[model samples]
Target: METAEFPAATSATDGWEPTLAAALLGAERAPPAPPGPLADLVAEADPGAALLARLAAEGALHRAGTGLGPEALAPTEPRDAFGPECPPAAATRLYGLLSEGYSARGRVEEWFALAAASGVRPPAWLFQALMLHRDSLPATAPAVVGAELDWLARACGEAPAREAAADGAEAADWAEGSVAERRAAFAAFRARDPEGARAALEPVFRKEKADIREALVHALATGLSPADEPFLEACLDDRAGGVRLAAQHLLPNLAGSRYAARMAARARAALTIESKRRLLGGTTHSLVVTLPEESPELARDGVEVNTWERRGGGARASLLRSILGRAPLEAFAEHPPRLWIELALRSEWADPVFHGLFSAAKRTLDPAWSEAMADITAEAYEGKVTGVRRTNEVLGMWAEALDLLPDAAWEARVGALIRARKIEVVLAVLAQGPEHFSEPFTATLLDWLAFVTRGSDALRRDLAKPWVIARLGDRLFPSEDAAAAAAAILARLPEEDTDRLRTQLTGLTGVLDLRAAIRRDFRSETTTGGMAQG
Candidate 1:
């Protein structure tokens, strides 16, 4: 099943070792992240399979400890000696953090660092809280998932949102509670009675401040439906710019929104599919483009005439793309994404059209559009296409489309990128991230990286480009096993030529090692020890 594109990874073409390195990638995972204390993990199994064993053992221990009677288990004294419990302040911090959303994810990672620094495992209740408040987990940031709760999300193909402690807040909480309490209350109420929630929110909507209004408006997404579009449309005129932006973003997703209808009108006026008679006697279809003039209506709907300026100057296409991007696919194109791509590629409007549909695909999450957009973006990166700039914005569009693609598609696209040795391209993709990279892909990516890092000229990226070499660790699996494998790079660097690179690599690897060490502490059966002050 492995592709031959990564020969440098499997064969010893560069006079480097490949046996231990083989375990470094393409398995279910890289080996268990073994830090100094658990350094022996490297000796126990191949790098790719060790993490599986670690998780299996942990799962068994978790079940046995939580389910079985205390008398049936091994004495806690031995377990306690090896692992220390997370300290009080850190434990409380984790409890507090669980309720926070993507905004506070950084703090959660810091909590892990502190707990790890203190050589302790996070409290068991923290795991429960994390799973309970799992909504806060970013669909990106795969590395920050410390607790093994991903399975719950994976099983459903989407993370299941467990209601918070305040999911059932009384009317008082919704009507007069603090902003925090109201968020949970409103979201919970919205999920069951969308209309009722709208009615309640609408009456007091004007009274809430700009920030509170913004937050409450975002909560509307929980029960988002076409019926909410009218309210959202009204929000487009709110005094706050952020609220206007939020509403502008949400409206396109509503299948029946007039916003989509208006955008569709603009699209029809701007672009048309015209038929032309060929010289040889056949007929051909052409996508003709004419950008719209700016107006108050366009501005009210959130279109900026200067999208071109912000996007580095493509005035006509930029304006047309704004219209096309906001309109739903059913209204915008008679053809499918692939055919539209064919037409787009032939026209000067390629990048804008492609980007516009990419935006639309993000809103709709249409698999067909996502697939075509992903392929086109990859091909652009591979230089098979032109006009689509090789910018992070384009890569971001690629990543967003990727979030909607199937796992198999993810493997195929990323596998090709790695095979081509598109280092920064791969890094950018991984940096923007997906829900999670499957085990085989994670293994393959890290394995290829490890293979390249050793003294091979084919692995030249680690030697020449700081963006490729230095930042490599940041986008990697935040585990001891992953870092330990990467640590091999340091041994191969020439002391004179790679001093700066060596320093950068050291810092990246150091962070991974610390994360791995923290994971090791968590893996041990925690018993009474010096509580982590973190």
Candidate 2:
């Protein structure tokens, strides 16, 4: 066995293998063939010419059992392609041929051995082509990919290395692909063996600055589960807020996610509405004052209220602090009216708000309070009408609030329409949309429609009406009033159509089980428990 060394025929500072491969393949040449057999082979291998043929043969052989990898093609006993010393041109030709031949035989171990012997650290472009041209490697080919990775890691030569490996085998392909695809790959790799990938990524995660760390963490998040929590927790205080936020976002989804639970507890206890009224500079009258949770109801419609009104200095704050101080949702439910609910919803405080609302609402089944709580949602959607940020914030609040309401109240109407049964009430209120067609108002309607369409079984009942059923199918039922309204309009329908409507509407009557509804309306509203049971 002779030692093989790649000679410096071309500048080795940067871009060697790929640049040479491109030129050797006659990428720039016209239709006519090059001078000899080598030229003919190069032309044939060119993407403009024979690349497709090679791919086809390789693909078929792969399906036929002659593909690459330990499973498809056995690794060849190691052999150096460039014996003694090889010129760059010879080395390039050898690598090209080796790539093609190995692909044909479904062998990459030979490619690995040759790459290792020549110390040929190909540029990303060349490496990508080399890998792509030899596309027989499995996703598990990271082992082979890593062989190249190791060379680049060691080569950290004078010039900057090609930024990323062609197939993105070096780092997770988080940046290059669609979110769903990248997410799946990242998650699968992490799931296969977390300790290995995470350990491999630790340095890059730590050393990379803010923006890079943010991207890395996002990639990591796709693979995140309880096993990754400890590491994510470590990043909570990362210098980059984005990194911190991404890590924080994943915390809640983890099993026994103590960090989120802890913060939620703290926020529930710490968040408060402090109110204070100061006399307008020169005027005798005072301005109304209210803090985070101090519902306008507490402040008195006409009068001002503030922290000074608290029995103990910051009573409002203390109230919030006390609320946050406890946990298990049950503790918060005992006093669900606390300002924290509104504040948490307003700011979209994910952990604290979710824990607080879920616990409180689950423990108590009353629907009127949920009805009034619904008002806050309307207010939220109304207040934050303009920007995308505000829209998200409002939507977030509405969703959590919808979750907290008694299942019945989640679909209940406010004011006069509340008297109607669930579907009727929802449709009646939805019908009011035309009377209140402002952008924010329209947003609230669409949002509610979407929620009712996609929410839990109890919530979905609102879409059961005949009109809605006709439009959205059995899954998205229409409201009763819509059905009634449709009936009233279509009552004059020819006997066949009316009979059809009657049959469709009558068939769904048994599906209306009021016992399943979880009414989550406001306490300020009627006390009739009709919706909750419905």
Question: Global lDDT of each model?
Answer: 0.63, 0.42
The TM-score of predicted model 2 comes to: 0.31
Candidate 2 accuracy as lDDT: 0.42
Q: Model 2, 1-534: lDDT tens per residue?
A: 233333332221222232344335553432332232223333364455554433343345345553232232334334323222323333354355456665333223433344444444333434545444434443433443445543444443312123444334445564346545555555556666667667766766677657666666676765566777777878876777788767755665554576646634544444444445657644222112222355432222111234555754554543343233223343334344534345545453433343445444434433644554556655656564222134644554455545555433444433223333334434534432221223333234334443444445544444544354332212222334333333343333234333444444443332211100101111112267233211
> For candidate 1, lDDT tens digit of each residue in 263-363?
88787777677878999898878788787776778878877767446577566666777877898887755666766765675577776776676677777
Minimum summed lDDT over a 10-residue window in model 2 is located at 514-523
Q: Count the clashes in each prediction.
A: 7, 40
